[model samples]
Target: MPPRNAARLYPLVLLLLAFVAFPLYWMASTSLKPQTEVFRVPPTFVPETWTLRHYVELFWLTDFGLLFVNSLKVCLVSTGLALVVGSLGAYALARFRVRGKEAYGRLVLLAYMFPGALLVIPLLLLFRQLGLTNSHLGLSLAYLTFAVPFVMWVMRDFFASVPVDLEEAALIDGASRLGALWDVVLPQAVPGLIATGIFAFLFAWNEYLFALILISDESLRTLPPGMMRFVSTTDTNWGLIMAASTLATLPMALAFGLIQRYLVTGLGAGGVKG
Candidate 1:
């Protein structure tokens, strides 16, 4: 690139960074500020006086810890189930020449594209009849509808990129299909698995619409729904709200950082030309 073009691109790059980082910076700043200082007209870049009161109040005055635990449990269980089921389904689709395989693959893709907003009411009613409303199990299962299909489709592509000869040789050596998958194919797909796990985890963690409508009890509420309870007609606590937002986003940041290497690997794995 020419120097002039590179200079022109620098402003755009800075703008993107500012757009993404400013909200996080504001949240963190607000979290540290006193409630009175949060909305001061002459906004201070740094807190004039720092306070841990909001964080303390969030934990003790509210059920933030319990809500965090609830969210964590739902995210972990749903992601784990999605990864296991999606991987197996993906492997079968990629390796086995079943009738209607193409149609089945398209069906899986279609499921991912399906709108969740349209199904929320019916899903709630179904869950109510099944005695799963306001339950963690029900929430996890609902998440699986989207997470499983997404993971399966992504993993199918990843598995297809792997050399089939490796699994074939393992099978020829008296290994069972499952054994070959467990011992041979899985190791090669570790990067893809990490990527899929991250995707599933985020979907389960950040899901709001379903969690909001399905859960009613305060104790059963996940972070998203629990956060909503903070807003009321009388008042809004911006400091505490920002603190909660910052805390809610931390796990996702850590998850992405941990899996970033695997994400890059998975993206690049299939691009090598023969």
Candidate 2:
């Protein structure tokens, strides 16, 4: 592209970023503002009076802390499972000469594209039959439906980028197939793993519909559904809501920040090499 064209698009790109970022900024800002300033006349773009009362109430006076912990457990376990299973499945599909390999690849992508809403009812019933409903294990399993497929699809491409020669050399050195995978291929795929793991964790952490439907016990509520409990017919605590929202967003932001250096390269490296 010409310098003139790039200059013309710069403003539009910044505008789009601002549009997306403003809501998050507003949420964080609102969480810090006192209730009095939340709906003040002319609306304060910046808070004049900051307070931590909402955070105090959210943590000390309510079960939000427990809810946050439950979410973390479910998401962490789900992401781990997804990474293990998806990586193995991806490696098989990439390295092995299996029958209907293309069809199986398409099927994995199709599974990922399936609507979560549509799966909710059947999953609920299935969990009940298995006596896993209302439990964190069941919730993690629910997350696996989508997480596994996403990891598998991304990892399949990533594994394709890894040269067969490396694995063959390891094999000739008397390393078993699994040993070669662990010692040779997996290290090269770290970036892809980190990127995919982030996606899996974020999805499981942020999902509300399945959590709400599957988990009836308040103790098991994740952040998104737990946050919703703040609203009621008689009253809605905006300060508390904003505070909870801010807290819930922090983990995902921190996770992304830690792996961001690898994310871009991890996502693109496979494409370049494959």
Candidate 3:
């Protein structure tokens, strides 16, 4: 607010930015460095011998492309399922008088707070029973454990914030409850849907433990665990790993940027409600 305070905060802001960005910078930088220099002492801040060999190896020699596709498939399908199921549940909670609604909502939140590692064993056993183990479907289903609750909570808040009068007017115009939601409420809730969908997508994209435990077939492995193919007890391919990490991060960064305008608008809208 004041020039003196602004000047004092600028340096601190820049320092925080560096702290957040340096790891990403290092990951990108290492991906470009020649293998011999990757582990060299006095680590090169910039690659002297920048090359695309690692990327070439990733696409041409490895199954990285397949892994990428697998990750994409899982993220899209799981996020879609989560959004569909969560939005419906959220709408019910927000719009109707359901008994024990608060208790049910709390349980959903608590389910999300449970550690993923603890769920893996029981999930594996459950999947085995259903013949879902080692399948993409199984992996996507496992992801729902966290994604659905998160989407439900967020969407519930957004749906609650929406004025009921809008949906009432739609209903008076010969619209059914579902029709009111589709025609009236959802249009206003677009920002929340985008934000929640993207969160679900990113969670599935970066998820490792469930993918690793649920899938043993190389073809089914997603990018996170698939990157481990580059490592062995003997040596690790740092360049390849860094390159893959950078590539994996790009789609997420791009998705966030695309929705950033709506996300900001949504945040501002949610800050104060009637």
Candidate 4:
């Protein structure tokens, strides 16, 4: 149940919700609108004649399916790589007696903060030299330059929030260090891992500049750059753009819906000390 004061916050909360959700609702509505109706003066709040023409064109006329597949491939691989490597790095930082661990943690955050613009030229040069340009694996690794550090930073706090006593107790029971981590520590970290993983996934899913610069081939493009195909030098396809955008939003929306129960608590704990 909401606290007494929360009742008074309802108006503000609803206002915020409308502020965020209206664009999404409008986008969906526009995607279903007939092209002629989309440009009508004053516009309709809801479509007069709903149709799937845009969505159909998105697949058959454009290679949105290929773009979607490319995005999914790189993102999933990069996210998995970041999670495994970052979790181990965070575990070491939080649990081991390493010197300057705090400084190292700060450095990770610093790397994450470096503007993508700064790395674009250097990474493009490096990947081209390494012949990683135009490859999904290269793109995935490029994503990692940011994704790994973010995962490490968040997971570090999460690992720190978990009580060391529990790991010690397992050790006292004769579990190996790795075994204790597997049996005890990881179970407690599930929510945090899932929350962090989702955040990392979002990063890769939406990143545009790197994908644009690194991959010159049309077939290799991810959604953000792929969306640009809808806009021509003379005209734009609003319906197809909106339809593609609306469809792109589904995976993230579904992911959040599935795990929102744990998201807040996990984030909160990761930000706090035990």
At residue 114, what lDDT does model 3 achieve?
A: 80
Worst 10 residues of 4 by lDDT: 265-274
How far residue 59's Cα lies from its native spot in candidate 4, in Å, is 1.0
> lDDT tens string, model 4, 1-274?
6688889899999999999999999999999999999999999998999899999999999999999999999999999998998888989999999889889888888886689999989998999899999999999999988988888888888988888999999999999998988898888998888888898899999999999999889999999999998999999889999999999999999999989978887888788862
Residue 150 CA displacement from its true place in model 4, Å: 1.4
Candidate with maximal TM-score:
4
TM-score of each: 0.92, 0.95, 0.95, 0.95
> Which residue pairs in candidate 3 collide?
none
Number of clashing pairs, model 3? 0
**In terms of TM-score, how similar is model 4 to the real structure?**
0.95
- Please provide, for model 2 over 140-235, each residue's C-alpha lDDT reduced to its tens digit, 9 standing for 90 to 100: 999999999889888998999999999999999999999999999999999999989988999998898999999999877888888888999998
Overlapping backbone residue pairs in candidate 1 total 0
User: Which stretch of 10 consecutive residues in model 2 shows the poorest summed lDDT?
Assistant: 265-274
lDDT of predicted model 1 = 0.89
- Candidate 1, residues 1-274: lDDT per residue as tens digits? 9999999999999999999999899999999999889989999989999999999999989898999999999999999999999999989988899999868976986875668898789999999999999899999999999999888887887888889999999999999999999999999999988888887899888899989988888889999989987889999998889889999999888877877988888756623421
Worst 10 residues of 3 by lDDT: 265-274
Q: Pull out the clashing pairs in model 2.
A: none
